[model samples]
Target: MAKLIKNSFSADLVRQAKFFKALSHPARLSILQYLAETKTCITGDIADELPLSRTTVNQHLKELKEVGLIVGTVEGVKTNYCLNTQAIKDFKSSAISFLEDLNIDTINCKK
Candidate 1:
Protein backbone atom coordinates (compact mmCIF):
# COMPACT_ATOMS: atom_id res chain seq x y z
CA MET A 1 0.00 0.00 0.00
CA ALA A 2 1.06 3.58 -0.57
CA LYS A 3 2.24 5.67 2.33
CA LEU A 4 -0.44 7.77 4.01
CA ILE A 5 -0.08 11.34 5.20
CA LYS A 6 0.13 11.77 8.98
CA ASN A 7 -2.10 14.86 9.24
CA SER A 8 -5.64 14.16 10.34
CA PHE A 9 -7.14 17.13 8.52
CA SER A 10 -8.65 16.82 5.06
CA ALA A 11 -8.66 19.21 2.10
CA ASP A 12 -12.16 20.34 3.00
CA LEU A 13 -10.93 21.38 6.45
CA VAL A 14 -8.17 23.45 4.84
CA ARG A 15 -10.69 25.07 2.48
CA GLN A 16 -12.99 25.96 5.37
CA ALA A 17 -10.07 27.52 7.19
CA LYS A 18 -9.21 29.58 4.10
CA PHE A 19 -12.78 30.85 3.85
CA PHE A 20 -12.65 31.93 7.47
CA LYS A 21 -9.28 33.55 6.87
CA ALA A 22 -10.84 35.74 4.19
CA LEU A 23 -13.30 36.92 6.85
CA SER A 24 -10.61 37.63 9.44
CA HIS A 25 -10.04 41.18 8.15
CA PRO A 26 -12.15 43.94 9.71
CA ALA A 27 -12.66 45.72 6.38
CA ARG A 28 -13.99 42.53 4.81
CA LEU A 29 -16.32 42.03 7.79
CA SER A 30 -17.69 45.52 7.27
CA ILE A 31 -18.33 44.76 3.62
CA LEU A 32 -20.25 41.59 4.51
CA GLN A 33 -22.34 43.41 7.13
CA TYR A 34 -23.15 46.19 4.67
CA LEU A 35 -24.30 43.71 2.05
CA ALA A 36 -26.41 41.76 4.55
CA GLU A 37 -28.13 44.89 5.82
CA THR A 38 -28.82 46.26 2.35
CA LYS A 39 -30.12 42.94 1.06
CA THR A 40 -29.58 44.12 -2.50
CA CYS A 41 -26.84 44.76 -4.97
CA ILE A 42 -24.79 47.97 -4.61
CA THR A 43 -22.64 49.82 -7.10
CA GLY A 44 -19.88 52.15 -6.01
CA ASP A 45 -19.95 54.92 -3.33
CA ILE A 46 -19.48 52.41 -0.50
CA ALA A 47 -15.78 53.09 -0.29
CA ASP A 48 -16.40 56.72 0.65
CA GLU A 49 -18.23 55.63 3.79
CA LEU A 50 -15.15 53.87 5.14
CA PRO A 51 -11.82 55.30 6.29
CA LEU A 52 -9.85 53.32 3.76
CA SER A 53 -8.97 54.48 0.28
CA ARG A 54 -10.91 53.42 -2.79
CA THR A 55 -8.12 51.13 -3.94
CA THR A 56 -8.00 49.48 -0.53
CA VAL A 57 -11.76 48.97 -0.60
CA ASN A 58 -11.56 47.45 -4.06
CA GLN A 59 -8.79 45.12 -2.91
CA HIS A 60 -10.92 43.99 0.04
CA LEU A 61 -13.83 43.38 -2.30
CA LYS A 62 -11.63 41.29 -4.55
CA GLU A 63 -10.50 39.20 -1.58
CA LEU A 64 -14.09 38.64 -0.43
CA LYS A 65 -15.09 37.64 -3.95
CA GLU A 66 -12.21 35.19 -4.19
CA VAL A 67 -13.50 33.28 -1.15
CA GLY A 68 -17.07 32.97 -2.54
CA LEU A 69 -18.54 35.27 0.09
CA ILE A 70 -19.70 37.93 -2.34
CA VAL A 71 -20.70 38.10 -5.96
CA GLY A 72 -19.91 40.93 -8.32
CA THR A 73 -21.14 41.81 -11.75
CA VAL A 74 -20.21 44.63 -14.03
CA GLU A 75 -22.87 46.78 -15.62
CA GLY A 76 -21.25 49.44 -17.82
CA VAL A 77 -18.76 51.33 -15.65
CA LYS A 78 -20.43 50.27 -12.43
CA THR A 79 -19.73 46.97 -10.71
CA ASN A 80 -22.52 45.75 -8.47
CA TYR A 81 -21.59 43.69 -5.46
CA CYS A 82 -23.75 41.64 -3.13
CA LEU A 83 -23.44 38.85 -0.64
CA ASN A 84 -23.84 35.24 -1.77
CA THR A 85 -26.76 34.62 0.54
CA GLN A 86 -26.75 30.84 0.33
CA ALA A 87 -23.03 30.73 0.97
CA ILE A 88 -23.36 33.06 3.93
CA LYS A 89 -26.25 31.11 5.40
CA ASP A 90 -24.48 27.82 4.91
CA PHE A 91 -21.36 29.12 6.56
CA LYS A 92 -23.35 30.38 9.52
CA SER A 93 -25.21 27.12 9.94
CA SER A 94 -22.12 24.98 9.63
CA ALA A 95 -20.23 27.20 12.06
CA ILE A 96 -23.02 26.98 14.62
CA SER A 97 -23.16 23.22 14.36
CA PHE A 98 -19.38 22.93 14.59
CA LEU A 99 -19.32 25.08 17.70
CA GLU A 100 -22.24 23.22 19.27
CA ASP A 101 -20.60 19.86 18.77
CA LEU A 102 -17.56 20.74 20.87
CA ASN A 103 -17.48 18.53 23.96
CA ILE A 104 -15.70 20.77 26.43
CA ASP A 105 -16.54 18.54 29.38
CA THR A 106 -14.50 15.69 27.94
CA ILE A 107 -11.28 17.53 28.58
CA ASN A 108 -9.46 16.69 31.80
CA CYS A 109 -7.35 19.64 32.86
CA LYS A 110 -5.71 20.61 36.17
CA LYS A 111 -6.24 24.25 37.00
Candidate 2:
Protein backbone atom coordinates (compact mmCIF):
# COMPACT_ATOMS: atom_id res chain seq x y z
CA MET A 1 0.00 0.00 0.00
CA ALA A 2 1.13 3.55 -0.70
CA LYS A 3 1.82 5.88 2.20
CA LEU A 4 -0.47 8.83 2.77
CA ILE A 5 1.13 12.25 2.54
CA LYS A 6 0.57 14.65 5.41
CA ASN A 7 -0.88 18.10 4.78
CA SER A 8 1.65 20.79 5.70
CA PHE A 9 -0.50 23.86 5.04
CA SER A 10 -1.91 26.14 7.70
CA ALA A 11 -5.42 25.61 9.09
CA ASP A 12 -6.68 28.76 7.39
CA LEU A 13 -5.37 27.54 4.04
CA VAL A 14 -7.15 24.23 4.53
CA ARG A 15 -10.39 26.01 5.33
CA GLN A 16 -10.03 28.32 2.33
CA ALA A 17 -9.40 25.30 0.13
CA LYS A 18 -12.57 23.65 1.37
CA PHE A 19 -14.59 26.78 0.64
CA PHE A 20 -13.05 27.11 -2.80
CA LYS A 21 -13.70 23.47 -3.56
CA ALA A 22 -17.30 23.79 -2.51
CA LEU A 23 -17.78 26.89 -4.63
CA SER A 24 -15.91 25.49 -7.63
CA HIS A 25 -19.05 23.97 -9.08
CA PRO A 26 -21.57 26.17 -10.92
CA ALA A 27 -24.53 24.32 -9.44
CA ARG A 28 -23.44 25.13 -5.91
CA LEU A 29 -22.93 28.80 -6.81
CA SER A 30 -26.39 28.97 -8.33
CA ILE A 31 -27.89 27.48 -5.19
CA LEU A 32 -26.21 30.17 -3.07
CA GLN A 33 -27.47 32.90 -5.41
CA TYR A 34 -31.00 31.52 -5.23
CA LEU A 35 -30.94 31.46 -1.44
CA ALA A 36 -29.61 35.00 -1.28
CA GLU A 37 -32.10 36.32 -3.79
CA THR A 38 -35.02 34.71 -2.03
CA LYS A 39 -33.94 36.32 1.26
CA THR A 40 -35.88 33.72 3.17
CA CYS A 41 -35.69 30.08 4.09
CA ILE A 42 -37.00 27.91 1.25
CA THR A 43 -38.98 24.75 1.79
CA GLY A 44 -39.68 22.09 -0.80
CA ASP A 45 -39.22 22.08 -4.57
CA ILE A 46 -36.02 24.09 -4.89
CA ALA A 47 -35.17 22.02 -7.93
CA ASP A 48 -38.08 23.58 -9.79
CA GLU A 49 -36.26 26.90 -9.90
CA LEU A 50 -33.04 25.46 -11.31
CA PRO A 51 -32.04 23.69 -14.52
CA LEU A 52 -30.90 20.61 -12.63
CA SER A 53 -32.93 17.62 -11.53
CA ARG A 54 -34.00 17.19 -7.93
CA THR A 55 -31.30 14.63 -7.19
CA THR A 56 -28.60 16.82 -8.72
CA VAL A 57 -29.82 19.85 -6.84
CA ASN A 58 -29.80 17.91 -3.57
CA GLN A 59 -26.20 16.80 -4.15
CA HIS A 60 -25.11 20.38 -4.80
CA LEU A 61 -26.97 21.54 -1.71
CA LYS A 62 -25.26 18.84 0.30
CA GLU A 63 -21.85 20.13 -0.74
CA LEU A 64 -22.75 23.70 0.20
CA LYS A 65 -24.22 22.59 3.53
CA GLU A 66 -21.12 20.53 4.24
CA VAL A 67 -18.98 23.65 3.84
CA GLY A 68 -21.26 25.70 6.11
CA LEU A 69 -22.20 27.96 3.22
CA ILE A 70 -25.88 27.13 3.76
CA VAL A 71 -28.07 25.55 6.42
CA GLY A 72 -31.06 23.27 6.20
CA THR A 73 -33.76 22.51 8.74
CA VAL A 74 -36.17 19.62 8.47
CA GLU A 75 -39.83 20.57 8.69
CA GLY A 76 -42.25 17.70 8.62
CA VAL A 77 -41.63 15.97 5.26
CA LYS A 78 -39.73 18.94 3.82
CA THR A 79 -36.49 20.76 4.56
CA ASN A 80 -35.99 24.51 4.67
CA TYR A 81 -32.73 25.82 3.25
CA CYS A 82 -31.11 29.20 3.80
CA LEU A 83 -27.80 30.93 3.59
CA ASN A 84 -25.49 30.85 6.62
CA THR A 85 -24.57 34.52 6.89
CA GLN A 86 -21.92 34.07 9.53
CA ALA A 87 -20.15 31.42 7.56
CA ILE A 88 -20.32 33.58 4.44
CA LYS A 89 -18.78 36.50 6.33
CA ASP A 90 -16.05 34.28 7.70
CA PHE A 91 -15.30 32.89 4.27
CA LYS A 92 -15.17 36.39 2.78
CA SER A 93 -12.61 37.43 5.39
CA SER A 94 -10.50 34.36 4.81
CA ALA A 95 -10.52 34.87 1.03
CA ILE A 96 -9.74 38.56 1.29
CA SER A 97 -6.87 37.96 3.67
CA PHE A 98 -5.38 35.31 1.44
CA LEU A 99 -5.53 37.51 -1.69
CA GLU A 100 -4.23 40.57 0.13
CA ASP A 101 -1.26 38.62 1.44
CA LEU A 102 -0.14 38.02 -2.13
CA ASN A 103 0.47 41.75 -2.51
CA ILE A 104 0.55 41.71 -6.28
CA ASP A 105 1.33 45.01 -7.96
CA THR A 106 -0.19 45.59 -11.38
CA ILE A 107 2.68 47.99 -12.17
CA ASN A 108 5.16 45.11 -12.23
CA CYS A 109 3.93 43.19 -15.24
CA LYS A 110 6.04 41.51 -17.98
CA LYS A 111 6.46 43.32 -21.30
lDDT of 1 by residue, 56-82 (tens): 999999998998999999989889898
Question: Which ten contiguous residues of candidate 1 have the minimum total lDDT?
Answer: 1-10
Off by over 4 Å in 2: 1-6, 106-111
Q: How much lDDT does each candidate structure score?
A: 0.82, 0.91
**Candidate with best lDDT:** 2
**Model 2 TM-score?**
0.90
Quote the RMSD, in angstroms, for model 1: 3.7
In TM-score terms, candidate 1 sits at: 0.83
Question: Candidate 2 clash total?
Answer: 0
Please report how far candidate 1 places residue 5 from its true position, in Å. 8.6
Error of 1 at 71 (Å): 0.4
Clashing pairs in 1: none
Q: Cα RMSD to native, each candidate?
A: 3.7, 4.9
